[model samples]
Target: MEAIYIDKHYNLVVECKQGSRKACYELYRLYSKAMLNVAFRIVGNIGEAEDVLQEAFLDAFNKLKDFRQETTFGLWLKQIVVNRSINLLRKRRLELIELEGDHLENIPEEESEDEDDVQYQVAVVKEGIKELPDGYRVVLSLYLLEGYDHEEISQILNISENTSRTQFLRAKRKLMEILKRKGPAS
Candidate 1:
């Protein structure tokens, strides 16, 4: 007996290319949750993030023909979602404020205020992240959470690499401050 073919990605792409709505929905169900997390981290709003996710899906479904498989489908889809999320930030006039020439040049990478006192809880961290200003939050989320390097982040956000690094550093410090105020993790 011949082995049954089971190329999920190939089959999904073929189905989607042939304009199967079910396949499209299947793709959406497969990727939307992770994509939503990525969008939410950047946009910092559930409604806006959902909007970005939907728009990304629309583009992905419609542009399925352009997906040449240079990368995996998930990666291609994520790129679209991230770009859309950044666009939403742009629509909001997300400003990349320059650092005010503070003495952050020598601040140790991992040192926080009273290092021994720092205890992070997931809830506390998410709240702290949400509290960050748009610039810092976007930089932090894109670089740390989304796995983009400084150069990629600079390009995505249209800021200098230095600015991206500075923003991440500032964001980390501010997050620590927020966590400290919230007290130790329970």
Candidate 2:
């Protein structure tokens, strides 16, 4: 059973790479829901997220040659989805406020003091993160949620690495502010 599942995935990728429409459909069926979740997380709007998914899949199919085997095909496709979602955000011309380097370094690292209630602390932090501005939200999602580094974020957003760092720091501050506004953290 395990081998058959693996073979199906591998064959779908190889056949899709070879321009087989049936393989592409199979791959899409397998990955689309997960890809849509990623897209919706980054884009935050269902309609826009769907658009990103479509564009991402098209780009992935077209550039199959460029995909090296450093990562699994699903991971590669997820990266494309993330990159395309970031591109869509940039196209909306959101103004990213550039923070100073010193400010970036000084972001407060407030680890939860109460160790007994870890789940509550995590829930508070998650809510705070969701309340951040769109730019900060997207940057935080790409950096922390999607596991992309500053250089990769720079390339994805066409901004400098410094800018990526600054945005991440600022996003953290914004999250803190949101948490603060939500009353005392228990």
Candidate 3:
């Protein structure tokens, strides 16, 4: 049996496709902030993320007629935002290195904190993510935040699946270190 996906914004999409400027603006307003967060998480820079968001919206608007609506408009726009963010990173010569067994061992793991001492704040975690290296941040954001699996991440980054796993593991370890240093409530 095929699953049916319902889009709450179907009318808006149809109107936008028919060249309704109000519909286009409404679509952008509904999606831009969430999409901006997605771009910012991947690109690690607000300015770059804003650029990606703008470009993705433009691309989506221009191609609205071609959208088949197999999925929600939000998901389609997210794909464009993520791709644009990655392309911007590529423009900066972002390199994702393949990890061999020996290289993986060289990455230090953070010591586990005491369960009683563990505390988390949204801002603290956000800052920790921002401190991560670009490659690690991208992989972690795609997997943990964006809900992509290792295989999808591998295809997106043009790296091996094993490399994606390694990057995610290292990113987790590094984020732990940053959170630990921030203190119980910080």
Candidate 4:
């Protein structure tokens, strides 16, 4: 069933690449909502996410000729949206810095702050994620939210795998600090 859906989009992608506006709109209709969610997760602003989505779609349309079939069309479109979101953040002078040695305490991945204990709302966690630094938020969103592994995040962010891991662990710690200050559900 999923394969058939992808095949249908594959046809749309071919027509879109051929400069068919109707096909382009059809593809956008199929993808825009989910792509907006992806952008919003990274930028943490609905307006910026909308702008990113527009810019990404335009960029994708322009670059359609260059897109080889190494990956699925949907994945290619997703990469465009993600890259555009990161670029917009970069344009705002948000640099994703890698911490030097000894800066971060080594916290094991399983040492989570016991999320179930608080009975906190999802909104609280989302707010905490927004409060994180640009670097941490990007890494955390890509990893925890987007389901990318550290290696994939490293490739996406152009950082070392170790750096991605360290940043993610630190991001978790910072999120925990924010949540703790917010206190448990009453």
- For all candidates in order, the CA lDDT equals 0.85, 0.81, 0.89, 0.84
Per-residue accuracy of model 3 over 1-186 as CA lDDT, tens digit each = 544468999999999999999999999999999999999999999998999999999999999988988788899899999999988988988898888672444446345465543434666789999999999999999998999999999998899999998999898889888988987662
| Tens-digit lDDT string for candidate 1 (1-186) | 533344457678779999988988888998899999999999999999999999999999889998776677888889999999999989898889665555464345444465344554556689999999998999999988989999999898888888888998898888888878987645
Q: Highest TM-score: which candidate? A: 3
Worst 10 residues of 4 by lDDT: 1-10
Local error of candidate 4 at 136, Å? 0.9
Taking the tens digit of each residue's C-alpha lDDT, what string does model 2 give over 1-186? 122223337777888888899999988999999999888877788899999999999998999877656667888899889888888887888667655564555565656656666678788877777677778888888888888898987788777888888888888888877878887755
Give the alpha carbon lDDT tens digit for every residue of 1-186 in model 4: 223334547888889888899999998999999999999989888999999999999998998998766678788889899999888888888766676563666545323355774345677888999999888899999998888898998888788888888888889889988988998666
Superposed Cα deviation of residue 181, candidate 2 (Å): 2.0
lDDT of 2: 0.81
Number of colliding residue pairs in each model: 0, 0, 0, 0
Ranking by lDDT: 3, 1, 4, 2
Clashing pairs in 4: none
| TM-score, predicted candidate 1 vs. hidden true structure | 0.85
**Model 2 clashing residue pairs (backbone):** none
For lDDT, candidate 2 versus 4, the one ahead is 4
